[model samples]
Target: MKKLILPILLTICVIAISCQQKEKQNSIPKMVNSDGSYETVPLEKDTLVLKLIQNSVRNVKKIENAKEVVNENLQKVKNLVVEACTTGDKPNIVLMHEFPLTGYLYGGRKDKVQMALQIPGEETSELCALAKQYDTYIIFGSYAIDPEWPDHILSLTTVIGRDGEILKKIWKPRNIKRFYSSFEITTTTVESVREKFIEKYGIEEELPVLRTEYGNIALSTVQLDPFIFSAFTMKGAEIILRTSTLFFESDIIYTAMANNVYSAMANIPADSPYGGNSMVVAPSGKVMARLDKTTEGVLEAKIPIAKFRENRKLPQYAIELTKDIFKQYQEEIPANHLDMPKEKLPQNGKEMKVLLDSLSTWLNQ
Candidate 1:
């Protein structure tokens, strides 16, 4: 009876979320987008453990054998996965921080493109092997390139499913580019190439929610963007998985509480002045498990998914009330500014700043 009811409830939950989106649309969503959500297989068990890797950051700019370094980083990750998954209770999901393989390379678009790895290339093949070996989901953020979007460097969080399949490729939603005075983030994101992205992948892919057997997980690299995070939750994300190079502890906690979803942030653990803590937070904004700042390790946490979903539903933000203000609001710099020809793309942070200034509505005004 319990088994039967759980399946029914899962179906109802998916419908409830899909129906809410359908209510807003006049026509049915395309087959590519599915019934307004990218659905996955049913839950395998009630309890799920997540292991967040707070690993060391190593930039490959100076390394001569960058290819070897990529494999070396992967080997380190393999060891970590073997260490964590084999000992004690195995984790259902293993998460890694931003730039684990190639790390942060300084350059213009050409250099960045040269440094980035292809998503389905030799590297992800190795990641798929691990996911298949352990029968778990393996997710990590990397600097990637796509043959479809030639010469463009991408900040992508890739999800590998249980059967060694590339489940979803989550592009960094938007970069906090204007904040820094000296330079700009040159990575191509959803906002950077909004028109082209929408034309190719559809709008739903902009803030995609991956419905998985473990839970409704949304992969992201966006930070300090309340609108982006809330929108994901409203799209039915039960758990938000994030990768970061920096820390804003308040940003993680507040977003979880306000959005009403479990949030886990995996950050780089380095012996430096800029080390941030990797943590998992509850909907109540309580820290469930965390690694000490600058520590190299896996921060493990358990989620009782079945119990958490008993009365859970998608969050309903006051969208109608604030829709008018949002419509009126204008951002300082216009998007698609970076969506230029490959040769014309800004090469470095300084060059990006110069290009952005000319395209900035605020500065020009």
Candidate 2:
């Protein structure tokens, strides 16, 4: 009888421990909603983690030397990624600043072409290897030469997947034609370049969203238009990554809030006076983490997918206003239009002033 009692007591203890473990497993923390209501939000299967690298360019004498510079910079990026992985907070996506391979330059088209890389060429292959090594998606920008036009070079932003695949490559629609024109570079004409871009890459009427494990991400340049952001959001983009030579804080914030999505901006150091302020903005349009304007470093942020979804459902005044404006001009506005005038663009400072005065007159009229 004593032996039976001992066995029964041990069994009861085991059952009690199993129940406590099950209860703990079922319990989850409650989250407060915007309306002050507490509710249990289920944990997401995956979190959207990101790292934006704000790099600085090292001046080199010749374009040929740019390759070495690029390799060194890439090594730095790899080191940072490895460190992040070691810390057990590895980022799922890493964004690089504009002109990561070769810094922005104004020179003869032929000279620039010599420095330009071919898409899926040697440079991008190395980037792919890096992406595979870290098992993270990488988005980087470079000046690339289209195979169709060996003499012409286009600015490109490419997305590399964790499997070392080229997911998407986008040609920058807007380039610094004004500076190129100043040098009498014939290949840099706005109309001619636009035609070449359209011939190779289709007209970018809508932003491209990359569907990934984290979320749908869109890549844009510094020349992003407000309408582009709206178009992306409408297409179900949850995060927009902007790689730029310059930082526009107000525009980034407005885009995040209006679209109710995360916005990450990666800019280079102020070595060329155009780089500064690499940052990540939350769905609420709040700056989450930012690198110093002059510093060259990596900024990482862990964005909650659940929170983004919640904020997206909230009422956004900008979106409401946009809808009202669209309704008012529903019939007047054309489906697609380019506002560029028939007249040639200004070629010099004096001509620019005259053109501005003419534009002002036209607007006032």
Candidate 3:
């Protein structure tokens, strides 16, 4: 009888432990699967005017009146938001170019980190208030610093809803490093800090699609990356909101047409070197509204979002056909290359390239 009692108690303990483990697993956010179908997205209105703002960033680093310069830039964004909401055909969403708050500064990690702002900080709060007043969604890109991730600068796209609350904070998916001969982006990206990022935010947050009454939106500053955008579409993204310092107009057309989704790009003004050509496009590669040239202004277009979402289905990827090839191919650089000790972090673009090269399987091969 004594032996039987001991075995029964042990069995009960095992069952309790298993239940706890299952609960923890269930607590995780639903993993976005391309192979699965999601519920139809809802819309607040039938037509929405998407205003893509072509503006310039105001650099305030190493200046005597940094606070004033930052305030002026913030005010510029607020003015644009007010104008878009009050303009002839008021916009449902206002988009801005990357670095509109703190423009790109040519410097090391430390210098740029100093210029990065915190999400939900003072600047975003002001934008949120404007969003509430205008009843319009506001989205923009900025270089941000987070206390959770020390010594790392982040490229971010913040989405504000009509309720004046931050709906989503989208991080740049990945940065293109191979194109430049002597330089590479030194900021923290999903690809750069993959392991730690997933650990903290979960894999679902890596390629999150912000589902709002306006539309199922996905925002990023990454350009020339079809795979990343395609993944977002598969995860039920109906619209792609892109922000960038410079213009890559052709890629926008390609992404929209191929994915069969509405796409918009907001680039800095022509006054800034290599800037301009901000535009909005439809799925059929039709240009909705475009800047004739690189200039500072707003490009607006009306999208029949309700009609567009009626029969929309997830992108039909030929995954089974290409599975073997994808599995066999070796990526140039493995992820988590920059997930090192803070003291060992790369300081600039050149150093970043060296670190990536050393970790490249192909380079070593």
* Alpha-carbon TM-score of each model against the true structure: 0.87, 0.68, 0.88
How does each model score on lDDT?
0.83, 0.66, 0.84
Question: Model 3 over residues 198-241: C-alpha lDDT tens digits?
Answer: 88988888999877788888899998899999988887888898
Error of 2 at 309 (Å): 2.5
Instruction: Please give the lDDT score for candidate 2.
Output: 0.66
The TM-score-based order of candidates, best leading, equals 3, 1, 2
Q: Write the residue-wise lDDT of candidate 1 on 191-273 in tens digits.
A: 99998998899888999988777888888998889988887876778889999887777888998899888999998975554
How far is 185's C-alpha from truth in model 3 (Å)? 0.6
Give the backbone clash total of model 2.
0
Off by more than 4 A, model 3:
1-36, 63-65, 271-274
Residue-level lDDT tens digits of model 2 in 1-365: 98799899999999999999888656522221345222223433457778888877653336777678767766776675566545647878889887776676545444666766778987678778878988888888876777665455556689998999998886554433234332322222223345444545544422456666677677877453676676666656778888887766788888888777888888887844345778889878889998877887678898887655553442343656577777765322122112233235333335534443444434445
| Residue 275 in model 2: lDDT | 56
Number of the candidate with higher lDDT, 2 or 3: 3
Off-target runs (Cα >4 Å) in candidate 2 are 1-44, 59-61, 175-206, 271-274, 310-365
